[model samples]
Target: MATWHRLGLRDELLARVPFSVTLERHQIAVFLHERRFTAISNICNHKGGPLCEGRVRGEFVMCPWHGWEYSVVTGKGPAGYDEEQVPSFAVEERQDGVYVQTPPVMPRKLVKHKPSHLLETHSKTPGAPPRVLGISTTAMDEANPRFSTSDALLEHAMAMARELQTDTQLIKLRTLKFQHCEGNYSKASHACTWPCAITERDPEDQLSAVYEGLVHWADVVIISTPIRWGNASSLYYKLAERLNCVQNQITIHNNMLIKRKVAGFIITGGQDNIQAVAGGMLTFWSELGFVFPPFPFIAHSRGWDAEDMQNNVRQVKASAALREASRELVERAVDFWKMLDQNRAMMDRPMERAGRKANPLVNPEDAIV
Candidate 1:
C-alpha cells in the first residue's frame, strides 16, 4: 500500500507546474496538462537529466543534454514506441489540496544502442605515410556549383598531397549546413564544452565532420579560403568561430585536443590583402597547438585594382606555376609533419597552456583581466 502526500494548493499547483518535488526518497516531476495533473519520475531515461529542468514542448518535455523527448502525460516516448518510458504515478485532487502518490520502482527498460561510424584518434600516431585533410570554405550553391578559384586551388593542393601517396580527403564547407557559434565562452569558459554543447544536443550538426578530422584523423590540414573584403572568407571565420569550442578546452580545463598536427593555408582573391588573412589564421591555429612548416602558407592575389573576376579565373586556371606551388605546399606540409613525428616524444610532453596564464580558471571571477 502507498501513501498520498500533499504537494501544494490546487490553484498554486497549476501556477507553479511543471515543477519537481520529492516524495519518500523518490524525485517526482509534476505537470498540469489539459486541465489535469500528472506525476512522473524526474530522471530522464537517457542520461539521468532532471526532466523538470527541461523545456516543455506541447505534451512532451525535451531533455537539454541530448534533446530526447518524453511524454508528460503517460511518460512514454514518441507514439508507437512503447519501449522507453518513465515511471508514472497516480495523482488525485481533494477539497483540501492536490495529492501525488510515490511512484513504485518499475522493471528496468533496455535502451536501444545506437552505433556511430565516426573514428576516434586516440592510440594512433602518424606513420610512414601521412593523412591530410583539405577544407574549402568558399560558399556557393551546392545544387548548381560555381567555378571557384580558391576551391580549385584547394583541390589541386589535395591532389598533390595524394601524389606523395598520402591519404587525403576534401571537405567543402559550402555543401554543409552548420550553425555558427553563439558565444557561450563570454558567459563562462566551461560553457564552451568539448565536442560543443550544440553538437551534443543536436545530432544533425554537420560541423562534427570538421571536428573529427581536425581532432582525431588528420596529420596535416590544408585550409583554402577566398579572401573577402581584406579578410578570410566569411565561411572560414564561421568555421573558426565554431572552433572556439576547441580552444576553450585549453583555457578552462587545460586539456589539449590538437597536437602533432601541421596546418597550412592557401589564400586566393581578386584583390589584395593576402598577408593579413594568412596572419590572422596563423595567430589562431598556433594558439590551438598546431605547428607550422617553413613558408606555412601560399597566396594568389592580383593586387587591389584587379577587379576583373573573369581574368582572375582565367589566370588561376592557366597558371602552371601556381599548380606547381600547390604541389610544393603539400610536400612542405608532409616534411614538417615528418620532422614533428621524429620528435613526437618532445612535442607530447606537457607544457603550460599559454592561454591559461592570461585567462586562468583557478579563480575566474576575481582574477585580474
Candidate 2:
C-alpha cells in the first residue's frame, strides 16, 4: 500500500520548493514549476550531492558538486543521458498542505562508466633505472619565452639526472593548458575523487601529464618554482590545489598513491623567502607519502629590495655554485630513490595514518572502533 506524507502547508512548501525533506529513511527533493509540484530523490546519482541544494536549470536540476544534471519532473538526465535517472515521487497539492507519496513512481537507474585510466595501479619495475621528473612552475609567455631563473635551475637538475644515468623528463607548467581546481572537496570529502573529477570529464586537461609522471612514471620528483611576493609561484599553487585529489585519497580512503618515491625542490626568485617556500613544499610532498632526501632542496634569492629583474636572471645564470647545488639536489634524490628501491619490501608496508584521518560524522554512541 502507498502512503502519502504531508510535507508542509501548500503556501509554505511552494515558497520553499526544491527543498529536501527526510521522511523515515527516504530523502526526497520537492520542486515547484509551472504551478505544479514535483518530487524526486534528493541524492545526486553522481556523488550523492544534495539535489535540493542545486540550482534549477531550465527543466532540470544541476548538481552543485560536479554539475550532473537531472530533470526536475521526470528525474531523468538531459537527452542522451536519459538512461541515468533518479527516482521520482507522486506529489499532490491539497488546500491544507502539500504531500509526497512513498514508493517512487519512477526508479533510479545508474550508468556504469569505465574507471579512468589515471586510476590504474602503478608498480616499480624490478632492476629498472630510476626515473626523475622535473616540474617547472615558473609561468612565462610560451609563444615568446624569456629566461626564468627557476627553469634554468630545473634544466640543470634534469641534466644532472641524465648524467647520473637516470631517466629524466621536464614539465613546464606555462606550456600546459589546464583548469584550476573547482574545490569539489569543499562540498564533501568523498566528492573529491582520485584521478580528479576534472581529469575524468575533460579529455584535454594537460594536468594528466603531471599526474602520469608523479603517480606512474617517476621514482623521484624535483619541483622547481620561483617565489612571488614571498610565496611560491601562482602556477605552483594552481598545481598544488589540483593535487588535493591526491592527498585527499589518504584522508577519505586509506589509499596512498605516492609510495617509495623521493622528492626534492629547486627554488629561485628575485624576492626573498626561500625557507618559507621550501617549507611549504616539503610539508605538502611529505603528506603525499614522498620521502625527502637529506638536504632535499636548493634555493637562491636576490633579496627584498633587489628587484632588478635582469640582474636576477643574469645572477642565476652566472652562478656556478647555484648550478652545482641544483645538480646535487637531483643526485641526493636519485640516491634516496635507489635506497628505497633496494628496501622495497620494508617500505611497501601500509602507511601509519592514525592521527591524520578526518573525524567521522556519526553519533558518539553509534561510533564503532
Instruction: For each candidate, give its TM-score against the true structure.
Output: 0.69, 0.90
Give the number of the best model, judged by TM-score: 2
Superposed on all Cα atoms, the candidates' RMSDs to the truth, in angstroms, are 6.5, 3.6
lDDT of 2: 0.87
In candidate 1, stretches whose alpha carbon ends up further than 4 angstroms from where it belongs are 1-7, 20-28, 41-43, 46-50, 53-58, 64-66, 87-110, 119-128, 140-147, 175-212, 234-258, 272-276, 279-291, 303-305, 314-325, 349-369
Error of model 2, residue 178, in angstroms: 1.1
The positional error of residue 305 in candidate 1, measured at the CA in angstroms, is: 4.3
Q: After superposition, how far is residue 34 of candidate 1 from its true place, in Å?
A: 3.7
Off by over 4 Å in 2: 94-96, 351-354, 357-369
